[model samples]
Target: MTTITVSPGDLPLQCLYRWEKERGPQVYLTQPTGGGAVLDITWAQAAQQVRCMAGWLQSQGWPQGSRVAIIGKNSAHWILADLAIVMAGYVSVPIYPTFNAEALAYILAHSEAKALFVGKMDDTANIKNGVPSGLPLVALPLAPALAALQWADLVKNNAPLSGQPVADGDQTSTIIYTSGTTGKPKGVVHTFNTMAWGVSSATHRVRMDVNDRYISYLPLAHVAERMLVEQASLRYGGRIFFAESLDTFLMDLQRARPTIFFSVPRLWVKFQQGIHGKIPAPKLKRLLGLPLIGNLVRKKILKGLGLDQCRIAAGGAAPMPADVLQWYRNLGLDLIEVYGMTENSGVSHSTLPGSRQTGSVGLPYTGVESRVDVETGEIQMRCPALMKAYYREEAQTAEAFTTDGWLRTGDKGQIDAQGFLSITGRVKDIFKTSKGKYVAPAPIEDRLVLHPDIEACAVTGANLAQPLALVMLSPDAVARSQSSEGRQTLSTSLQLHLQAVNAMLEPHEKLDCLAAVTTAWTPENGFVTPTLKVKRNKVEEVYAPHFASWLAQGRPVVWADAS
Candidate 1:
């Protein structure tokens, strides 16, 4: 067996040059058009377009290392634009497509981007308001009609860039803004060497090759998707696929039949709920207990989910519920938990493929060092791929690291005897009740989401008698609650669930009641981040005024109208 090795100093462009010479005819990207139409771009074709775009970028004659912004959902053109930015000796600033007008404007103005590349987006109104006046705008192939330069026109007009241009390893490659939950988003700057080092070192833990395939559905603006899907594909010469839209996600997954799949915990829970919708849990459990029928049922479920061919499946960005993790394991899928953050270039700890430990996020990746602060119980880490600084914010950057240089992850955790790391909670997420006892919401919320009726939850009580849990029900549960009997049934089940969760907690940490929120928690509503993380501060702001009143009249379960 042979393996591809990359040094810490290797650049992404160098890998592209290698693939262009070795696998030029092989398809590198598969993009879905509406109505099931598709476009397959070979390495040779991608290289030519990237080169031409690079030439056009150079023609603008922006100073080297000037910031260039990209805003769009995940697509082949998104990746190509990023590569072109790098090839043109510019810094790429990727803004999440779901960002509202304010966030979009902040990043663009703050980065001082010389130009912007607009790609596939569900809403163009945000872009219209967010883009500053007189800034250059280039539209990708899938972009909606906009008053901007066309990508096809530029490629057709400019010749391919002469020679294989490479960026210096130490030059800035990108500035990834954190999907902040508390305050304004901060820009995390990473150099070419740091970004390349992260992707290169990750291969040692999860192997990939030219034959590997992936579906790039997660936002490429996120560090996880950028490193795992885009950069990893460039390094290993793998084929990358794009999901057309949310409506066609399943069809896109089936088309890709990806060999490597990565997803967050919320999506994983939704997948489980979808499976249970088709096959009830009790009957499915009974079938899985049988001898040969169990294997067949497992395969059928995996096939239906479009993950039958997945050799490596992992979850990150948040903790995986214990029951959900075990349920996928029972289906013969090794769904390991990966733990990392944007500041670390998305490199930290990950569970090995076949060596999973319950309730732990595995061991740290090779070349990574981790420790838990004795006083604060915070998890601190040092790795070669850590970011250079928080862009332009000296105070925040200084606060993000210790004097000795370990990145402060802001997460509290424990390291087991076997070296497995189990996250206890976020340091900033802990709240105190009126009695002055602090409660860690993460561990308790993990237990709350295990109920099939609940989709998401937040446990919060500041200076109150007892902490209470505010929960958003799953879509099926919400629909079922429309009827009188159905509402009563859901109320009783939630009461029981509240009792079960309380029985496991200490007196001060126990919840007062379970409040069912009638409104949805979504990114648009500012209830959750783009990555689906609950915004604790937002939850507190909207529900705090009614907390005392609800606690006074509350039984084991109560209802709150967010709207």
Candidate 2:
């Protein structure tokens, strides 16, 4: 693989022009249409369409710097609309399609978005109702339910925008609302330079080129996917493929054969569960332990999963279980865990390929300045790609930064002598017990979820004398626990599992009991964020009251039917 050098120009739009001029007919986006068909758009075509849409947006006479919200799933038109917003001198606000009507309304009103772009959605009527009464709506090509100005019609009717306006480096390009796991979403403001510099600098660590293919399945509204997939494609001229739907995800993955792939730990765990379901764990482990057949088994599994062609597989958004990481490594895949936040342009630490260390997010990317504060152990960073501010919230923005200037990451982490960073937990998530010991629940939960049957777990004690674990079992695990005999078996196994986990922890940090719950924590339930990180506060709010009762029962493991 030859190294591809990219001159990321002062603006991302400039890079678009450069790619259009050099690789005019090269396919830039491969979008999936209905009935197993795909629509390929070349670099030149993409640029022209963007310009046409920009011209239409300019004609709308929206004020400069006005917020124009784009609500949709990942698609070709979504990226085009984001670019058109920047080209038209307005700020782009991308909303998660999974957001409820209430969240949609909150972001629309808070950002004061003048125009709305609608794309493929599950509940079009509900989303449409969330749009402000007077906001102009433009439907993307696939959003047929929305009776609004069609995207393709506008592009065909308008002429290409002449003389694309150059954006100032400090000009706000987009306002990305954080997944409000704790409360209402706060808008994160990023400038053109922040996007360009962050993506370019981070891509240097992982080599990319026109030949590289990527699957854009993760919500592009998240900063990590936006930077890694969208901006990386802009900078490196890579071909991007979009997943059509959940049912066709594997087929889409097989079709793309992406060279670089990224997914949150939750999805990664699901993939593991899917494989384990197809092949029973003990048999699969025995097969993999064989010398001759192991290679063939791993290859067959990788090919089946459509990851045979993947070179750099990354896991982020939450701490990946070490056992899961090792499972992929055993199959000859280097799955690196990356660490970052929305305030930092999602460019922080990443494990290098072939040099991966499980449980660590690796060293900070080149040109990124990172340090752990002595007192709080909170990670602070100063970089060119850091967000400008939280939009319209000066008090919150001021609190985000230290008195000096470093962006406070709010994550408690430690850097080893060799510069590798390991996230311990969130500073705010640390809770004190009634016994006067402060406990960080993440490390404990991480250990608990290492059990194969456990899907997700949260540790909470708060005002209680000792901490207890609230666990959500995997689907298969839930099925196993349905019968009286199966439940007893699972209870015995998990009790021993908890004993083993407790053996490794200090007395103060040990979990007093484990409560196996029936309810699965999911994004739809407001228990997990879009990025798949468990909302610790939300989990504690629902389960803390039961902790004392469970502990008072004097049982090592208590089963709660929380469904």
Candidate 3:
């Protein structure tokens, strides 16, 4: 594991050139084509394609700093297009592939993008209505058929850009839009220097090298993926693999055998549930306790999940349930919990390898400075990688930072005596009951989701007598509920689960009842963000009207669709 040393001031393009010169023949990206076929791209090959595309972009005569937008799923071409955009002296704006037509249109209009690069996407029905009339569009290799210039044509028509061009450190590199859990998405601006600083500083803690392998499946639009996968790879010169689709994700993971893996809480939970489906929880637990057979069972499970080679498995985007974290640990994985936000380049804190503490997000990164506000208890941190500003939002930009300097994280947290940070809840998310008791739903929701049948849960009862939980059943649970016998079993299990969760909570925070809903919550339905964090406001808006009726029912567990 030889580590690459990069200067803190080196920009992304600088690192790209270094890798192209040193690791020219080494594979840089492994992209999955349909039907299990993969295309291996070398560093020199990727550099040539990037240079040709950059030349084509430069020939278009857009201003040096004009905005260039990319909309698509994670693919090798997506990364190539981003590098080309920066190489052409333009700013890149990456939009989530799952964004609705309305969101797509708003971002394009807001950013005033000069051209758009379209790549592989699961759904393109919205493109017809989402893209403004007559916007210049270029299609990547796997992009759906569209009336646009093709990437192959551009590469054939243009010569590679002549010399290694360097971008100014202070120049704006990208405008990343937040997932917008509450309001309209705001563009977070980061300079080349800031982005470089984040990647360089993070590598000191995470320890990546040319021998490492990574799979890029998370939304590249998110800051975390951008920094960890794209930029980090450039700095460390590691090979990256792309997941073809949801159906082939496991195959992709097995193919890559990634040495470093990162996932959100929801996906991690699904992985756990998948294992339990094959081996029931109680039986699996008993099997794992045997001295001789336990190791074999652990290896089999890890190999089946394609995580046997993983040295660093990380969870982020939301607080992972303590029980879920322990489940992976029991299988010989030290799952690290990372904490950060879009405004901070997602390089704030991460638990060290082999030193994980169960209920904490771990220590801050080398250059990060953190403190909990004395008055509001909000976590505040300032670092070199902090965003420059919110694009075109002067008032909001001013409000994001304190009068002195630190960026307000808006999350309430506390630093323990050992300097580990534990997030309590969001300041804006705390609500009060009618009796004047305030309850934080995050902790309670964490406990409720420990039930195998529960997929997602939200606790809310503002101004009501007692707080209540709205739960969405797992796919397995929903399938079983089709039978009367299975439904009865689920009802009994949920009632007992409710009682156990309530016993662990304070009187003011105990849930009145658990209401299992029939509707599925997804990004398409505006219930969850692309990162899969529940939109608390949206959940309350859709279910608040039924609170009184649900309370009136005397049953401990009620079905929202039941008559």
Candidate 4:
């Protein structure tokens, strides 16, 4: 087995060159098409494509520090464009394909992206309409809507770059825009040195090597997916597979047979639900009790999940349910929970391979110094991989760091004597869905209250499949709902209002149900704080016991039913 060693000064393109020379024929990526075709590209071929793309980009004579944006799903060409931008001395700005027109426009305009690389998109028309005029558009092979120079055309017409251009380790590598709790998304700037340091630490912690294979399904724009799947692969020389689409995820996973698997808790729950759908919980438990049968069943279950060969399975982005972790462990797979943030280049803490602690997100990684703030209990850390600053936001950057210069993680956590960190809650009011998307309740609550019928609402969904909005009807609205006919009309209006509200929310932030409490909440009921603010936790405590029932009702609006 060969071990690849990379230094901070060594650009990723240089690593590709080494791989091309040492093992040119080795398959680097497997790109699947919706038509059931699989395209296997070798290291030599990928290097040539990247070189050609980079040369073409350089020929454009874009100024240094220019921002080039890539919006696409996880694919080989997406990565090729990223490498090309970096090697051509431009910074890459990756936008999530699912981003609405508003988000897409903001990122491009804010980043000052000179060019955009478009790939497979769910809403091509929305993208076409959102893209500002005069921004150069280069369509990838899979982009069916854009009438621009295709990726293949560029590769065929341009010559491969002959030599690696000198790129300083301290130069900005990319600007990753993370959704914020207010206003617009914030751009997190990372230098080549930051990325290199982070990836090196992650690789060391995960024990990655050349023989590993990864399935790239999550958005490449996200720092977690980039680190675990893309950056780790580049640093350690691992083969990567791209899923064709969500519908074929299982098939793609089976084909990849990845040695390294990383997914968010939502998908983990879906996997559990999928297995339970096939094999009921009680039946599974009974079957596992039998010695010979249990072993066979476990192997079968893992094989079906495409994790039979997985060496390192990890869940991150949000807290994974302990039961779900135990379920995987029962099948002999230790699903490690990783904790990190984009500001830290996704380097912070991760549970070691065999050190299984159900709720804790393991010890800090090498060179990461962590402490619980005495006043706020927020987890703070300092590391070499921490981003230099938020792009164009000096005030926010200053606020992110403590007086002592440590990065505040904004997560309330407790460190055990054993050094394992358990996240107690978020310091901010933002709550993350199972899919790991953050929902800022304030914004959503503001929208909900605008409806004349709704007086106040609290948005909550901690560890839930989706967020729920607890609605309290206004007095006039409640007075009209006494009659059966009036109640029906109100329900209809509320349903319509719910739909309208959902239309404005991101997929993960969409409410699962609207529970309208008959009793009014006020300061007298202790549901309001002394400052006249809603005690969100108190409201949740009173109604949380009914949440499962309300969720199970499956109605968009479930009225108090006959018990």
Clashing pairs in 1: none
Worst 10 residues of 3 by lDDT: 1-10
Cα-based TM-score, every candidate: 0.97, 0.94, 0.97, 0.78
The TM-score measured for candidate 3 stands at 0.97
Candidate 3 per-residue lDDT over residues 1-563, each given as its tens digit: 23333353368898889989999999999999898899999999999999999999999999899999999999999999999999999999999988889999999999999999999977687788799988999999999999999999999899999789878888999999898788889999998888888887777787999999999999999998998899888888999999999899999998998998999998998999899989999999999999989999999999888899999899999988988998999989879899988899997888888874688888988888899999999999998889999999999999999998899998988999988999888999999999999999889988888887888888999999899999999877888888889888988999999999999999999889999876778888999988889899998998888888888887788887673
Q: After superposition, how far is residue 495 of candidate 1 from its true place, in Å?
A: 1.5
Quote the lDDT for 377 in model 4: 78
lDDT of each: 0.90, 0.86, 0.90, 0.82
Per-candidate alpha-carbon RMSD to the true structure:
2.1, 2.7, 2.2, 11.1
Give the per-residue Cα lDDT of candidate 3 at 351.
82
Alpha-carbon shift of residue 108 in model 4 (angstroms) = 1.2
Q: Candidate 4, after superposition: displacement of residue 542 in Å?
A: 21
Worst 10 residues of 1 by lDDT: 1-10
